[model samples]
Target: MNGVVPHIVQYQGSKRNLAPQILQYMPRKFNRLIEPFAGMAAITIAVAKQNRAKKYIVNDLNEPLIRILNEAIETPDLLIDSYSKVWNEQFLYPEGSVAHFYKVREDFNKGNKCAANMLYLLARCVKGSVRYSSNGMFNQSPDKRRNGTSPKNVASNVSRISSFLKGHVEFMSKDYREVLQIAKPGDIIYMDPPYQGVCTKRDSRYFSGIVFSEFVEAIEKLNQKGIDYIISYDGSCGEKQYGTDLPEHLGLQKILLKAGFSSQSILLGKKELTYEALYISRNLQDSIHFQNTQLSIFDSL
Candidate 1:
């Protein structure tokens, strides 16, 4: 909690800041941690840093993102070298960082979704958020705040990420349900699915959308199987709420966590902290609360 865990890259909607609070509800150990919407594998990275899970499954609908995470975790030196080469080339263009950023974005969209090129686009994109056009192209503009992350900094973090998750992770680029279907008793899943309504939009941040009814059905199935899971689906900032709460009959215990401030609030001319909804499976929630109570009692003794 004193310092941040090393993430492979900065991503929009990443739960990096909220990870500490989320971790509080997690058991001290689990056989596996599965993330079906693992953008940059944020929670998995955080959990790995704490050595909470023995095995990990990181899956996403975005192929390039999964590729980047795979490259970062499996071969840090190679990833570092490729990323450095790509980042340095931005300065080589006379038109400067903005021009170079667009060029990288172009290559990424042109089926050159190699980890390095795709990663550069994400690092340089506006607000570090991912946007795609209807036909599945990288559509975000450059964030002229400067060049993307420095190669030196990226290299350091990549190395640390590799060390954190090298042997324990299995990366997948597939429909999330496939990953969820394979889950067994010893697995605890952490999901951060794209927001409901916006996912279907062509230019929305998520590459793909799951129908609301479909998603709820999937959750119900997981519940029926007694799977331990936590979801970060809906949240609020200031007076604006993002999405509807999960249905109560699902038997989840909902907890609100003060995540980082919402950047959208800044656009609305108000600075407000965002509170994310964490819906935990009832069994896991009860177990966590009981363990916490016993710990408090022990501390007071």
Candidate 2:
């Protein structure tokens, strides 16, 4: 809603485009904002841009992903320089872009980990999406059409992102439950945990998967503690659904944000409309400040 907020990267399952609509549900200001699943921390960036929260906690299970995010925020110079090297190195390969991407993937999987490698991989991966093998390795294929974001643009983005959140935010590579346990009444937690169907069991986009029952229990505890939260859980694209619905016993108020066409579906030659559901905690929806969120959900679509 404000001029486009700077982001570290275009992340798969990141709520980047949907963030503005989501922000309409949040209070204009709060003590803190916590993202437990924090992939690319899109919501955190959005909230920071709006100056909605005094502090932020960006946590994720993927260490490499979190490492790149940290570098973007805390050490922009190093990230840009190293990523530039990683970007330019691809052209030096005898086999061209495809070979370089796999080599980087090989090196990363073999323990040569760094923020630069992770950023380059995320940028060049197909559909900006990530895929991991059951053995916990980076296996996503390169896009092959593009090399990735240039160093100049990356520097600009890192600078802007750092300006918004550098001192105000803390990074964590902890379990979401640990973060949930630390949040207090005055703070707001915006959770975008991996959707169930694809991001659960053996098919996980993350290094780890959340047990649905445990996740539900965690939210239930938050309700008991009087903490306000907004959850981006499950939704459908035309007739194709993504994950299971939250329990009705939790007493959440569901609002559907029409998120337009799914890029993945479009890639598959299906132009399907996608609607992502936002599950608001009971007290949050009842607050006078947040009551109109449902009515304004479509405004940004």
Candidate 2 local lDDT, 268-289, one digit each (tens)? 9998888888988887777745
Model 1 regions lying over 4 Å from their true place: 199-203, 264-269, 290-301
Q: Estimate each model's TM-score.
A: 0.92, 0.93
Best by lDDT: 2
Task: Give the per-residue Cα lDDT of candidate 1 at 288.
Answer: 73
- The global Cα lDDT (0 to 1) of model 2 is 0.85
For candidate 1, give the lDDT of residue 266: 76
Candidate 1 similarity to native, TM-score? 0.92
Residue 294 in candidate 1 has what lDDT? 23
